[model samples]
Target chain A: MPRSATSSARPAGTAAPAHFDFDGIGTSWQIETPRELDPGTRRLVLDRVEEFDRTYSRFRADSLVTAVAERPGTHLFPPDSIGLFDLYDRLVAATDGAVDPLVGRELELLGYDASYRLRPAGAAERAAAEASGPAGWAADVERDGRRLTTERPVVIDVGAAGKGYLVDLVAELLRGRGYDEFLVDASGDLVHSGREPIRVALEHPLQPGTAIGVAEVADASLCASASNRRVWGDGLHHILDARTGSPAREVIATWVVAADTALADGLATALFFTGAHRLAETFHFSYVRMYADGRAERSRDFRGELFS
Target chain B: MNTRQKKLALATMTGLSISAALAGCATDTPSSADAETVAPSTSAAASSAASTPSPDASSDSGSADASSSTYADGDYSATGGYVSPNGPEEIDVSVTLAGDVITAVTVTPDATNPTAIQYQTQFADGIAEVVVGKDIDEISVSRVAGSSLTSGGFNEAIDAIKADAS
Candidate 1:
């Protein structure tokens, strides 16, 4: 594998990758630069995304989510999932289960089931759903070495940090294929390959076009979050709190940089609910926080290179 | 034909579109979501017009209008969620109207990871609800969870969303 300095600009002579369009994991997708990569390289990268989807997707029939939820006390390793169980174990110890995997069952009951396309539910329906489905990470799952069994038949939705990890994998594959300066951005859970830092504009969660801050990242993962972006009156939109099956509202938006995209992605979600003061001891990364009330906070470390 | 090929394509496109949209959404802020919501319905209606206009037409309009209303005044929310092909993890996000424009934001931390139970409910709502009625002009986000770095990125998005709304 060849590693080089990172640059936002595309290199000369390399064919721009082909762009592929499709849908999975409750969202539409498009791939660029597929044409540029060798056939074998392309195949491996694509396979990785599919495997993760199968293990994690609630909408899919054979997903590990369905397998685990439908069958308890069984060791089910997804043929191709993101190995989220592994990440969950890390988070459990890192944040002490502040963000648990077992909350899948409660999330489903809270009206966050797989069938939930991006449409809004009625107020009454939303209220009733929130009533019966409150869950916590404490009781749903028990894990052993590379194996996990759900204590109950709860839906496990992994729509938060999965893709970020995928980005890291694909970026790694690109390096293996001899591409040095590349960005493996899986819907903003992106990782860059190269020594030079890449400049990314941080979007204002509340205001779309305007950039509140900018960050320069080199060989690190960057992730962002925003609360006021998409929601309904019933307080139900995307980004469900597993504990309550509702949207999380602690911090408006969060951005994180870490050694890996997976950690950055998980930390982004964990920090969104964890709060800055609490984050002081738990997380080890550079960050910038924008509050719903217009107050912005940045870690002492994050301030060094992110801003001029 | 293979699922791998499709997923590869999906991942690539998703990455590209996110990059492009991030830049696009930045320039067109306020009305970007409106255009996003309206553009699809208009195209759908144009296609549907070729079909029968039945009792469902009104219903379709109602649903479209409800979602479309959200896009008005640049108070729009677009979620680009994805799950990796290697692990059982996923990311979901939505930007909503705070007060006049969009003043609130929320992020579900590792909705798949079973460890973040405590910060899920009130914290999620608190972040999102705080933006309920605020204008795009006045919005902010702080580190509220274990991952301040992540919260900072989210706050950056809120600023982008609000700037777009105006």
Candidate 2:
């Protein structure tokens, strides 16, 4: 439910934008628009979010993604998940498998399973989990029309890229409804639409209540990934490298800006391995990363001003 | 200074070792694939020079010098391969050029691994569709096989194609 609808007028020169906040997919969500959305439009946005939540959420046993785990063989894929698949396909190529979706099993074995509980698994449990799923499943996943045939029972997690993908989808829905100049912030994965650029603060990885930098964006999105938070049980956290099956240690935090929110999110994860500027020029995104040694690297043309 | 600015501006005041130096020499560096090799400033100049392709006729790192080719107007095919972490993966390319204008192109990636071949085949077919009607010198593929090794193999074949056309 929306915590509060801030329709209150602002300063004389500024436009009085409407603000919306809600919780879904286990995170806080917010929307800001220059004009208030009609009740029908609001319902449409929520319905789309719920639909995606049901289709992709592994936490829900009835969700389609969980069904992928429950069934080992080919299943008729969700009609709309094709876009998600394509985004992931491109991301895998772009990031050299750093942005893999097949990491779901790794997360589950680490006690980040459907229950959302935080407990590190024992050595035997990890070995058992490793036996159940393959580390790389994208190449094996076959998509023909509405059918997705998997060679093996793959527990792919879209969490790394799905949240940002959903954010873009919601932004598209809002734009389709003739709502211009809007901002969609889905638990810090943001897509800011509008002619006016928005200034965003980069969250410091080590220090609480501190920002590492400020970025400005117009008609684009910003996504960040850090290995510091979401910690539980002896250095285990949300971000897991498929290669190592542990938290990324090279870089502590990463921030990337891209035209698409999903792309930005995936690139941020990739930045952990490949420094922000060192990534191939093929990816047209700008980034700034804080390394484990506390050194910072920023792209030459990274879109905003450094805090200095 | 504000707390936020203080945290960010530290890159300037403190000797945080600005690692952006890799941005310059990394452009034509053949060792761009690995992320652990970014020690620069002292060794950046030496490593970058040592890694740069000599462009000598025998140099295998650089793609085929399109300029060396005598103007041709027929179909050209060449095979290129790159050794992946697993093993050697190769791709074959055929470009039908009508007086420097590409009419059609096709890529065939040959590999024993299922995923590697899949990406190579997909990229080969896709690259042909994209490069048709364009000059060979203008063909620049940023990504193809979801993996850099596959992309490298694809480029290797394209370089060989230029050599064949020449």
Candidate 3:
């Protein structure tokens, strides 16, 4: 808790915190730091985020993911994208196919397609969208190094974990350059760095702008998922339970804190299907899960203060 | 652990007001109120606090029954989280301090896996015999009931309590 005023390192002056914000990959990102970020480093950080969008964005025609989706044959997904595939594989297995990257097709069928239209398939959505089995994308797609192939048509959207992964990447960039104490907030998925723990408000699923409680995250990432936001049609939001080609209704919102952002982001989505204890077996995170009825449950390790 | 080459420990504490106030808080439970008090808007305050991982907002103010007490004679409680093969285990510990003596101790473990929870329960039920009446600092958190995951957070809470007391 030593204040900067007493630190010998800043005899000349104290470094006030600075923040850099920009929009990318469908969400805004903010970098919070205690020191001035040089112009070059700022550009590097910005470029890294834009790079991920250009590479994995399913909405963009120029994105590699779109290319893979449009082409049925085998293709290479740039070297770094392999890491993303690895993540998807693990998520598929970890959450019992609850967090599938191949869900892009399901999303598109429901009217959240690349054309930027919200044309949900209508009431018949249940019959038409439920064609694919749970986690079947795992089988449809094959990977060899950077190369990937699918037996049929598919659009892989890293949307769920993409922002989180990029957040980690930017956090790494900051740390690599010697800036230690910082928070990289990609939309709401965030990676916190430094010695002290910060308080994160668990957003209320039903009540917009209201928080269920507060959670603390120290040197870790805090990611949240809510079915209330990003709606396109009747009872539809971004988080589909995979088992059902519709939105998850059991758990309305989840806020999880883990050592990694992408992992935290994925786990938050998984909470819609599984509870705290079951998820604990595969991934390590502290969470607060709010049900549709407003009842909320939290992991014992949750570092933040809970309000009754 | 994914390496994010960041030095969150790098804050020079420049113009830091929170570190100066830590002296008064080392003993009690840090609650949401305390967190909000120091930095009303956790995100903005810490972001404005010159960026040092949000300052120890883990201190829950609701559990401040022993704020006036010290490690020599007071009470402390904290919740710690760790991962086991089952996923994650949360351990909550509350201890009473008498000088260096551990007047009382309670360990609570919460887990998703039944087997993991069993280990957590075993660790909780047996931890008192190892720490109560012993010097708080001397109590080494060895694996108990095969539940090693809960120890890190338990020990962390104890350390937080010790800091508050000493």
Q: Which candidate is the best by TM-score?
A: 2
Off by over 4 Å in 3: A1-15, A122-135, B1-166
lDDT of 3 by residue, B34-103 (tens): 1111211111113222212111344433344554643234545555555666675555545444433444
Ranked by DockQ, top first: 2, 3, 1
Q: Which docking category, incorrect, acceptable, medium or high, applies to candidate 3?
A: incorrect
Q: What is the C-alpha lDDT profile of model 2 across A1-308, one tens digit per residue?
A: 22232422233688677887776676667888977888888888888889888888887888877888777667876666777788777767665676678888778877777764556678998788667555675576776755777766677788777878888988989989998878898756789876656667665566544555667767888887777656555777778776557776656677777889988888777766543323444567776666555555565456654332
Retained true contacts (fraction), each candidate: 0.00, 0.00, 0.00
| lDDT of all predictions | 0.49, 0.58, 0.59
| DockQ values of all predictions | 0.01, 0.02, 0.02
- Which window of ten consecutive residues has the lowest lDDT sum in model 2 chain B? B1-10
Residue range A33-91, candidate 3, lDDT tens digits: 87778898999987887888788888778987887777778887667676667777777
Q: Order of all candidates by TM-score, from best down to worst?
A: 2, 3, 1
Q: For residues A226-299, write the lDDT of model 1, one tens digit per residue.
A: 66544423555445555444567646777788878777777777765564434434456776665545645555
Please say which candidate is ahead in TM-score: 2 or 3.
2
